[model samples]
Target: MKQGVQGSPGKPVAARVPAQARPAADGGPYRERDASVRGEHTHEERPGAGQRATVQRSSVRGQILDALRTALATGELKPGEVHSAPVLGERFGVSATPVREAMQQLALEGAVEVVPNRGFRVVERGARELAELAEVRALLEVPVMLRLARTVPAERWTELRPLAEETVRAAAMGCPAGYAESDRAFHRELLALSGNEQLVRIADDLHRRAQWPPVRHGRADLVADAAEHMALLDALAVGDLDVVRGLMGEHFAGTG
Candidate 1:
């Protein structure tokens, strides 16, 4: 049995009842026990509920990842945070399997590191490391923004205004999910302006990583960030390639 702190000490642990123990459609002894447990329901009792729960679980995983990312961004999930797979699994009411999977994904994205016996933990970035990464992103994206300025038509600028408005609203409201989505929308519009599909994909991957930090709603940080974005748009509007490049460099530097 997988041991985890399911509840308060000595509280009846979640019994690892097997699939075969679940009631066969006829409502046998299995159904009786399943029903007697107060407020406890299994996937077998409600067919669609299982699917719904699976969806909910997937959503929860996303939430967990968001939480993990926030912790890392804010330096909570630091070098010695003891981010054991089993402990995290227990906190999220999931088996270690999904936690391991999520950790592996994080590792692939440079968010976490896995040590042989210690499981996984956030990757600590030194000042120099962060500066270098920021420089790399700036080199890759600044020219892209300049290219967009030269290539994107006037009509496309108007088309992008709505998403920019949405981003401003999201940042103002301090809704993390809304902010994340709106931020994505704003960048996607920028990428679309470039008209290079490959550039769009690469830019998306880099942009998504910036959403890791948690922003307090209505905070000065968000307001300042939004103002910077507005500045970027204004520079783009003027077709000032050098200014746009500088703004993009600053924007990515802020992310790191």
Candidate 2:
């Protein structure tokens, strides 16, 4: 039998369980990792002045991608196991075509591998690769965030406090997916203050991929991580570039 969420401590890997992977003691459906983040944080996107069809297509794609990400995050579809497109299609209440397409996108992101005649396998990453990913994200994010911390008005940073707190609430509630989504919202909104769409999107992707290490055996780290977001804003509020720089470094380091 596949290990439900975690394998033996010696391996530190997760594998696929049956569709009915038992919930934790909290009555949640799955272990609280990416338990259900995207589903919790709803985004309101209105169709633009025109191009309704285009907007609809994008929205559908977004939903499929979110579902796939959740499955991967929650360990519903585990690393090193091949999963067929139709099975995922059924899980997300979508058609196989879109699931296949989304898996292809994940393949490009190094999150999965396309298996000829089989479908796709979640990509298993090692500690070295995770560290490398962290380095790349820090290199892309740290400099920009530092500049923004000093240049952006203090009041603007204050605006992001609630989102940070929301992350803690989600984590406390054992909603990994919710925490992931809110955490993304908090960071994306914070980065948006930089007025650079490309940077925001890039950092957002890295943050999602570099999920904050979960509470392996307790909730202390989860609460601590949530507080870190607020502390970061506090640093920015004081216009302390040195403190902001230090916080940014430590924050990025913790992701790996």
Candidate 3:
């Protein structure tokens, strides 16, 4: 597994593992490319689902990775929090092998740290590290927002607004988990608008990392966040590049 940024309760840390950046489904050094052999897919092979069939195997690994990612992003696994293989295995309803395997992948991806005898721990980013990530986002994402401003499909916003609204409402209700998922969905949809898969993936990883910190207790405040999203939607309607860029920047910066 690739190593991610490491933070202590009292110290800031950032360590990234290279292999973690590869598709999570295929992250482990021992991963086989074929999903059927891995028992990740059970459907009988069809004639024309060639590529689709192969992709399905990767889907299990992806689901496992996503589950871990979501757990980390939502602060369910706080920075430096350690979870044993047996515990995680039981929770996920798999054997320790896959759980251990998944942790290794996360470690490679810079999401966790592994010790010789101790189990895996979720990585933590110190305030400074968090700021650095925000800077990176500001640099890479702001331009994408500009591109989106120029090219976004008029009808796409309609599809996006509801999700954003739902996110805001979830946050308002102090439903951190729901709100976080909605928030992720909101940005993922925005990235979809940009129509750049690579860019979207990078942005997603960054956004997921940003959400590592737990939300403060403020249901009313989250309600206000809904307003913030609505404001961005309005900017989208008018093609206000400046507002779009500004709001997105503020949104990410606030996460840190």
Candidate 4:
């Protein structure tokens, strides 16, 4: 199994993996393609009633990825439970190829592991490990955000308000899967304003690791967390570097 980023209390920590920038402007090592992030579809519908059951989506692979993410978030796909591509493909009513592809991408995201002949299992992370991850994210994201907040111009911060609000809406969705994706997008866009894809990619990995088996977390927590994004944006607009720093540090403190 692929090991955890920092590992839990007793688990062995793996060597830090460098973040690969997606779609590096010069076409670097990072693979630019992620089916789920393709923005190919807005909504998914399960067809039936008068018509035959059909999976309506712009990309079959994207749908599979979304389903897997939702399953992970909802505990439909529990951590440490191995599931084969064929079985998962049948569950999603698709061929094994797409399932395997989606699983491979998830593996890169530090969400799952390849279990030899056995299929894949979500990596189980402990509370301490998750807190460690939150610390790393704050270390990487906060300083850069504060630096940008000072020099990025107030108008730019104003422009990013929509993305921050988007995160709030996603959190208000009251579903882990939807909120996770939007939260990722909001942070990614916020970081991208720096014009550094590599930084954004590193933050992406940290963000992905922050989401794991939540222990009975509820909608109220999520809404409050989403509101934090707005708080960050507001602080940015206010041009208070110290406030931005404090907000960012506080946002990640107990986040995981």
Q: Against the true structure, what is each candidate's TM-score?
A: 0.67, 0.71, 0.67, 0.74
**1-256 in candidate 2: lDDT tens per residue?**
2321223443322233222222222222223233366455422224452354344444555667676666565555566878786665545444455567778888876678988998887777777767777799878877878888768888888888888889889768765666667877988888788889998988877776676233122356566677788888998888888887888777767671
Q: Which sections of candidate 1 miss by over 4 Å?
A: 1-60, 73-76, 173-185, 207-218
lDDT of 3 by residue, 1-256 (tens): 3232223552212222222222323333323334566677433445675565345435544555666665665565777667776556445543345457777887866778896676887777788978887788788777877777777765767667898888777876776656767877877887777778998889778766666665444677566666677777778867899898888777767762
Query: On residues 1-256, what C-alpha lDDT tens digit does candidate 4 reach at each position?
Result: 4322122453222221122211222222223234348754332223342121122221455666766776676665668878787666545445565567778988998878999987888889887888889888988888888888878887888888887787778767787777777888888988898889999999888887777665425788888888888888888887888888887877787562
lDDT of 3: 0.64
Ranking by TM-score: 4, 2, 1, 3
On lDDT, the candidate that comes out on top is 4
Error of 3 at 179 (Å): 1.9
In model 4, how large is the Cα lDDT of residue 109? Answer: 82
- What TM-score does prediction 3 earn? 0.67
Q: Rate the local accuracy (lDDT) of all candidates.
A: 0.59, 0.65, 0.64, 0.68
What global local distance difference test value does model 2 have? 0.65
TM-score of 1: 0.67
